[model samples]
Target: MTHTPQKPIGSGFGPASTADEVIRGISLTGKTVVVTGGASGIGIETVRAFRSAGARVIVPARDTAKAKAALATMPDVIVEVMDLPEPTAIDRFASRVLSLTDKLDVLVNNAGVMAEPLTRDARGYEMQFAANHLGHFQLTCRLWPALVRAEGARVVALSSYGHRRAGIDFRDPHFERREYDRWVAYGRAKTANALFAVALDSIGRQWNVRAFAVHPGGIATPLACHMLPSEIEASQIFDAEGKPVIDPENNKKTPEQGAATSVWCATSPQLAGMGGVYCADCDIAIALPSDGSAEMHGVRPHAIDPISAGRLWQLSEQLTDATLD
Candidate 1:
């Protein structure tokens, strides 16, 4: 696939566009949305904003009881037990969802595990890569039919700045013989998320289904809980005032702020004819410098490279034997 270097298309929204702001005039009354990790943090907030906009949000969570309790006060929000760490669970959950809904307007791959001690999923894939990328990859394929049935469906893969640190290591993704650094694993997974969107868009565009990868910016959310206090201190994410340090000039978005990009990508008319782009601050991101360094302006070349995306897709199919066309 050939990718064009991205340029903002005058979205009329910026870094501060809240979720509510993005869907201001839209009504999702009969639309169905699936949000992973919708029981907490930006994910839950995303659920709330979508539900309020009239979408019946389905939250697939690891803990059914916990998700039910957390969403007890929210109407039109249903909880289903699904654990991404277990591929079988995801398969089961997707089957159940398909039985209930014929069309899906939005699918948000928002659940993720950050830097943690090395671990593996039930299938023996590295935990960070499995939960963060492959699980979502499989789920999207399982849900493809429903997405194609909808008039216009969108898939949002939540990527992050951490992608800057690493690219997918197709040669040794399972970390079978190599020492593992948690951050590097997380980076690989996040990079996979971006690549997934690239390939998904290539295949789904004909069905009026577009895929977008998003960087929600720096938000103080549970997604960062794996880091120690010392790491947080060194991150300079907080200000002397103890509030989340926001550098307006540099453009850091809060959770509500961060969510804007996903919501925007999912709904904004500005993207009516668009697909397969890395988005931040509620707009398509500028392309990274072709040199491929961490300190670049846009997505890493490897992340959206067609050859890499296709390679990962084929590996993923072999890993799970999930061949969805």
Candidate 2:
């Protein structure tokens, strides 16, 4: 598969564009969407945008009660139970979804964990990588038939600018040999998210099921619960006076603005033939050089490399024992 160039195609929407704005005129009356983290943070905004556009939305959450409460105000939004870190739970959830729908129009892999202490799932996989990438990988594979049925389906993986921190440590991804650093682990997982999109898109495009990875900017979401106040401030997401900065140009964003790119990647007609690229601020992101001198914007070569994406896909299939075919 030829790679899609990483340069932006001048999508009219900018960083400040909110999810509602990007989806304003589009109609999804017969569409069905699954947003993994659709109960909180920018996930809520993502669900709202799709729901507003008349799509059927399903939100899978680990905590059913909390998810229901968070989304109670939104009528007809289905909330299901699925824990990303557990393989069995993911399979069961996918089965449930498949039983309900023959065609899935969109899937947003938005749920993720940020920097946390070194921990492993039952499979001994690192927590961040397990929940953020492998789990989504399994879910997408399990839902493969439905996605292909849609014929023009789109999958959006929520990656991060933090991917700049590290690439996949294929040898020590679980931190078995190397010492664990929470931030590096987070970066590795985020990189996996991007690569998953590349690989998935490469294969899925044949069935008109394209995939995209999105950096939803920095927002004051519950995703930061693992970080300290000082850490948040140090990350520049918060001001010295303890306020969340809302600078879109600098990647700081509100929940609605942060979800813009994900919504765009999923529903924008401008991206009909495009996939396998990293997106941010409602446009395909520019690819950064491998030299590592560029600022914390755009995608690194490793995250979008077709070879790495294929390698990661194989590794993920082995780790999760899941396959699309």
Candidate 3:
């Protein structure tokens, strides 16, 4: 398969576009969608948009009560329990989804943990990497049959510009050797998110199940609860009065706006033949230069490199004991 270029294709939507706008006029009446983090932040907005378009949405959350409360207004949206960092929970959740429907039209790996103090999963893998990458990796493989059944499905992995912090450290992804830097761990996990898309798209295209990685811009959400006030202030995503700034042009966006690109990637007709590209602002992100210039935006070579993607896939399968068949 020819690689899709990491350049915008004039999607006619800009950074300011909302999920409602990107999905306008599209109907997903009989479709089924599974958004991992569908109960909070941009995830909720994404679920709202899909529901508005008439899709049957399922949200698998680690905290079912919180998820149910957050989604209470949308009574039709299904809520199940699954923790990304837990392999047994992921398998159980996948089984439930398959039992509910034979096909899955869209799968958004939107749930993730950002920079946090060193923590590990049951297998001793770094928490951020475990939940953000390996967890999704296992879940996707478990749902492979459902995806193929759809015949024209899409998987959107929520990556971030944070990936620019560091590439995958193959030798010690779990921080077993190197000193643990929260930002570096977060970056490596985010990079894994992007690379997962790159590899999944390459493999799934044969089954007409394409995948894309999304950078939802910066939005003030519960996802940032782990961030310190000083860090948040330094990031400049908030105003003097402590209000979350809304500046889509500069990547600071509202939750609805942040959900736009994920919605577009999953349902847009404009991207019908596209896959395996990093997207932001409702369009394919341009590739960044290798010289560290223009680092704040665009897809970096390490994130989209096919070779790295393949290697990550192999590593993920080995770590999770799951494989896409």
What are the lDDT scores of the predictions, listed in order? 0.85, 0.93, 0.95
Compare the candidates by TM-score and give the number of the best one: 3
Query: What TM-score would each prediction reach against the true structure?
Result: 0.95, 0.98, 0.99
Candidate 1 vs 3: which has more lDDT: 3
Best-to-worst order by TM-score is 3, 2, 1
Q: Per-residue CA lDDT of candidate 3, range 1-325, in tens?
A: 5778899999999999999999999999999999989999999999999999999999999889999999999999999999999999999999999999999999999999999899999999999999999999999999999999999999999999999989998988899999999999999999999999999999999999999999999999988888988999899999999899998999999999999999999999999878999999999999988826566889888999999999999999999999987
Ranking by lDDT: 3, 2, 1
lDDT of 1 at 294: 49
**Cα RMSD to the true fold for all candidates:** 1.9, 1.1, 0.8
Which residue pairs collide in model 2, if any?
Answer: none
Tens digits of lDDT, candidate 1, 160-236: 87888788888899899889999999999989999889888888888889999998887877878899888888877
Clashing pairs in 3: none
